[model samples]
Target: MKINLFPLLFTIALFYSCINNQSNKNDLTPKPYKVSKNFIPINKAPRIEYNTFNNITQNQYSFTNTTSNQEVSILHHLDETGFHFYQGLKFKDNNLGVIVGGTRLRARITLNGGKNWKEVSFSRFANSFQSVDFSGNNIFIVGASNYIYKSEDFGKNWSVFDTKYFFKENQSRYQKFKYYKVRFLTEKIGFIIGEHERHSVILKTIDRGETWKIIKNNNLPKNEKGISDIAIISADELIITTLSGKCYKSIDGGVNWQLLYSGENTTLSSIAFFNSRTGFIGGSNNVLMYTNDSGKTWKKIHMPYGEISDIVIHENNAFITTSFQALDEAKSFIFKIDSKGTNTPLPFLTKKDDSVFFEANSYAIQTLNNHIYILDKNNLYRTIIN
Candidate 1:
C-alpha cells in the first residue's frame, strides 16, 4: 500500500496555515472587558465646603474606587441650603434622579445624571421629606408631619395620600403617626413604618396607594423608639430596625411581628439583608449586630467606629459608614465587611480627610452600574469595589 505522503503533507500545511491565520486575526491585547461606569459629571466645579459644628454645607465630594483605592471622581451639588441635610437619594437611571431633604419642603430632581439638579416644588407637602422609594413607574415619598405622596409618572406629578386615617378621629401629637421609612415590594403591595407617641405603627397598602390599613399586631412594644429602617425581602418576609435598637421580623406581610432582637441603650439606625436569611442591623453608639437564622438570634460584632449609620451589601462585600457621636471627625470611617463578617476598615478617607471637612454625615450607600455612592446631607461620593 502506497501512503499518500504528498496529500497528507498538504493537509497538515493547510491546517497550520489556518491556525496561523486565526491567531493573527485574534489580537493578543484584547481590550479589557469594562463594566459600565455610567458616570455623569457635575456641570460646575465644586466650591469650598463649609463645615460648622452641627451644620455642614457640602459643596464637593470625592471617592476612592474599591478596586484601585485611588481617587476616581468628584461631584459637586448646589452651594445652597436645600442641598443640606439630605434625607434620601434615589437615581432612576443613569440620568433622572430625585433627592428629598432640607428645612423647607425642599426636594430636587436631576435630569442629566446628577450634573444639574433643580428643586422640585411639592406644593402639597410642607415638611422635611424623609425617605423616597420607587417601584416600577411609581415613586413614593414619606416624611415628617405624617405625609406620603405618590407619583405615577416618575415624579412629574404627585398626589397626596390621606394618612389621617392612621390616627384616630381626634388629632393629637401622641396619636398622629410620624412616618420615617417606606418600602414597596411592588406597585400595589407596600409598607411604611412609623410611630405615634406610645405605639409603633406599620401601615400596609395592597391596592397601590388607593387605600392603606394599619397592620394590627399586639406584639409591638409601647413607647418604642419607632422604626428607623425597613428591609422587604419578599411579599411575606419583612424586617424592621428601630431607633431603640430592636429588630422585628414579620413573615406574613406585616400581619404579625415577632421580637427578633432587643438591646437596652442601643439605637439601630439602619438595617439591610444580604439575603432572605442573613442580615445586619446598625446604628448609634457603635452598634453592629448580625443575624443568620432569619433573625432568630443576633450577635454583636466588635467595630472600632462609634456609630454605624448605614450598611449596604453588594454581592459578598458589605460596606458600612460610621461617625463619632461626639465632634471628632477623625473617628469617622468606612469599613468593608466581607462575607465572614470580618471588619476591615478601608483607607478611602485618610487622604481626603482634612481637619475641616467631615465624613461623619454618611447616612446612605447605594450601587448603580458597578459604582457605589456614599451620600450624606451635603455630598455624594462615588467608588468601586473589586
Candidate 2:
C-alpha cells in the first residue's frame, strides 16, 4: 500500500527588501532583448512510427544528416503505463540516464543510454516527482508533500525523507514544505526551493542530505506569489524566479538580495546558468530572459513558441521545449537554436495527418552524442541535428 499525504508547507514571499533597507522593486529594471518579429519556418523531422500494445503509438523523429544528407533515426518503446507521464530527465553520462514522473513515486532508469528503460517505483505515494537532480553519484528526487528521495548509487536504490518542519513558537500543526527544484553546488552544499502556505521557502543542506535548515532572510520576497525556480551560479551568487515573472539575485549567499527583473505576470518555471556570467530563465507565454553579466541586468529573448517548459544548454546550442497547461494531443514542439547568434523556435508535428499541432505540454529536453531527446506526454521522440 502507498502512503498518501497532504501538502503541508506553504510560502508568502515579500518582494523587494534588499540589503541596506532599500527597495529594489523601484530600481533594477529589465531590458528587452532583440527578437525577430517574424517566425522562422519550421519543418517536421522525418520520422518512423510504430504501433505498440494498448493502442499506444511510438514516434521516432528521423532527420537527414546535414553533412551526409542521409536519413537517420532510432526507436524504443517503454511501458507507457509505468510512468503515466515523464516530468523530469537527467543524464549522468552519454549512456546512463533517469526519468521521474507520475502521481506516485515512479521513476525509470536507462543504463545503455535510452535504448532500454526499466521502471523503478518507490513504495510510498510521492504525488508526482516534480524534479530530478544529480551530483557525482548522488541522485535526488523531490515532489509533492515535501517528500525527498535520494539515491547514492547511479539510481540503483533509494531512500526517502521529508522536509516537513514546524516553527518553534507555532507548533500547532506540522508545516511541510513541498520542494519544486533542488540544485547542488557541491557535495555538501545544496539548496531546495519550494512553497509553504502560499509563500516561498528556501531550504539549504550543508551536510549533504543528512539534514536541512530553512533559510529565513528579510531581503527575500514575502508575498503570496511562490518561487518558481532557482539557479545557483556560484557559492555566493544565487538567482530565483517567481510565479509573477519577477527575478531576484543574491550575491552574498542569501544575506542580501536585489530584484533583477519585474515586468511579466507569468510564472518562470525553469532557470539555468551556463556560467556565473551567463544565464537563461523561461516560463509561460513565450517568456525567455537572458543575462550576460551575472544577475545585474536581464533582457527578454523573444521565442517563437510560448509556454516554455524545459531548456538544456550545450556548448553553443540551446535545446528548449514548449507546452500548454491543458493537455492536447495536437501541439508539441522541441526547439534547438545556435546561441551564438539570433535564433528562433522550430515547430514540430504531433500528428502527421494534422498540420495544426499546438497544445501539448513538453516536459523534458535532453541531448546525448549529438542526438536530441524530447519527452511529451508518454511518448519520447529522438532526433539528430544535421
Candidate 3:
C-alpha cells in the first residue's frame, strides 16, 4: 500500500534517459539557412556599361554598379596591359584577358583566381586584329583583313585560319575590313558576323575556324545588312541583329534566317538570349525588345528613355546599358532591368565624374564573375570596390 518505489523509480529513470537521448539528437541535428548576399538586385547602388563605342567621346558610361557585394571582387585592374582595348574573356583554371592593340597587336594576360596576372604576348601576328571568343580548349581571335587566329595551345602561339570570304577577292580595303566581333558556342562550331562595305556579313565555321564558308540562308532577304552581332541561344538557335535593326532568327545555325522585326529604326548593337525562349536586344532609339518565345514574337520593353547598347539577362534579373538616359539629361547609365521590366539605376556605374573607358562603343558591355566590364572609349574598366 505504501507504494511500489522500485518500479516507479525504474519508469522515471527510463523516461529521463529517453528525454536526454532526444535532447542530444536535437542538438546534433544541422540547421538550414543562408549567410546573406544570396538575394538579388539588392545593392548599395547600380551601374551601367556600353558594348561597342564609335569613338572616345561616344564611349562613356553613365551608370555604375554601386552595390557593394563582397563576393563580387575586381581581381585585377591594369591600364597599361589593357592598352588601347581588350575584347573577349575566357575563364579556365585561370582567367585570360585578350587585348587588341592600336596596330593589330595582340597580347593575353592570365589570372590565377583574383590574384596576379601573367602576360602572354604575340607580337608577330600584331596586324589588323579584332575580337576573340572561347570554345573548350580552343582560344580564337579574329581581326581586320579577314585574319582569324586560333590557339589550341592556350594562347601560347596562334595559327591563322582561312576566314577568306573577305580576303578571297583580295581587294585592298574590303579584304582587310575590320571584323569587329567573334563568338563561339562550341569548339567545333562557331559564327562570325561583321561589317563589310558598311553592310552586315555573316560567316560560319564548321571546323573551329580552320575553314569557313558563308551561311547560305537564301530566304531572309537583304544581303547588304551588316550583322553587327550574334548570340548562340542554343546549339540549334541564334539571335542575329545588325546595325539596321534587322533582327533575324537562325534555328538551324546560320544556314537559314527569318526576319523577326521589320523596319526597326534604331540599330540593334547587342543581342542576348538567356534561353531559347527568352531573349532581349539592345537597340538605338532607347529600344529594348524582349521575347519570351525565342524570337518568334517580340514585345518592346519601354525604358521610358535610354539608348540601350546591350542587354544581359541573368536568371530573372535583366541588365541593360544605355548611352544616355533622357531623364533630366542624366547621361549614360547602367541600370538593372527587373522582371516587371522596371529599371533600377546603379549609382556605382552611373555616378557623375566617374571616368569610363570605351567611348560610345555601345556594343562593348559585358558581365563576368559579377564584375561589370565596359569597353566604351577604346579602353576598359572593372568595377572593383563597388
Backbone clash count for every predicted candidate, in the order shown: 3, 18, 50
TM-score winner: 1
Candidate 2 per-residue lDDT over residues 1-386, each given as its tens digit: 96444332221122222432354542453322222222111111111111111222234445443333444343334444444677777776756766777646566776675666666654344357667777667788776654566777765555555444423443323354566777788878888887876688777777776666777756775773667788787767888887777778888887677887775567888776677677788898788877777767777777765577777777776777877655445443666555532555555333333422233566677677766666766455555644
Model 3: per-residue Cα lDDT over 1-386, one tens digit each? 68779999999999999999999987776433222211111121111011222111112233333354323234434444333444444454335544443333444444344344444433333354456677677766665544455667665545554444333444332243456668777787788888655655677766766666666666666555667677787656887888777788877877777778754467877787777777677777877777777667777776655577666555666666666523343444555665544344343354333443324333445566555554443344456433
Candidate 2 local accuracy as lDDT? 0.63
Question: What TM-score would each prediction reach against the true structure?
Answer: 0.74, 0.70, 0.65
lDDT of 1 by residue, 42-138 (tens): 1111211111121223344454443466664444343344435675766667566667765454566666656666565443333566777776667
Model 2 misplaced regions, further than 4 Å: 1-83, 123-126, 166-176, 206-208, 293-297, 325-332, 338-341, 346-359, 368-371, 382-386
Candidate 3 TM-score over all chains jointly: 0.65
lDDT-based ranking:
1, 2, 3
Which residue pairs in candidate 1 have backbone atoms (N, alpha carbon, C) closer than 3 angstroms, thus clashing? 66-384, 86-377, 286-306
Between candidates 1 and 2, the one scoring higher on lDDT is 1
For all candidates in order, the CA lDDT equals 0.65, 0.63, 0.56
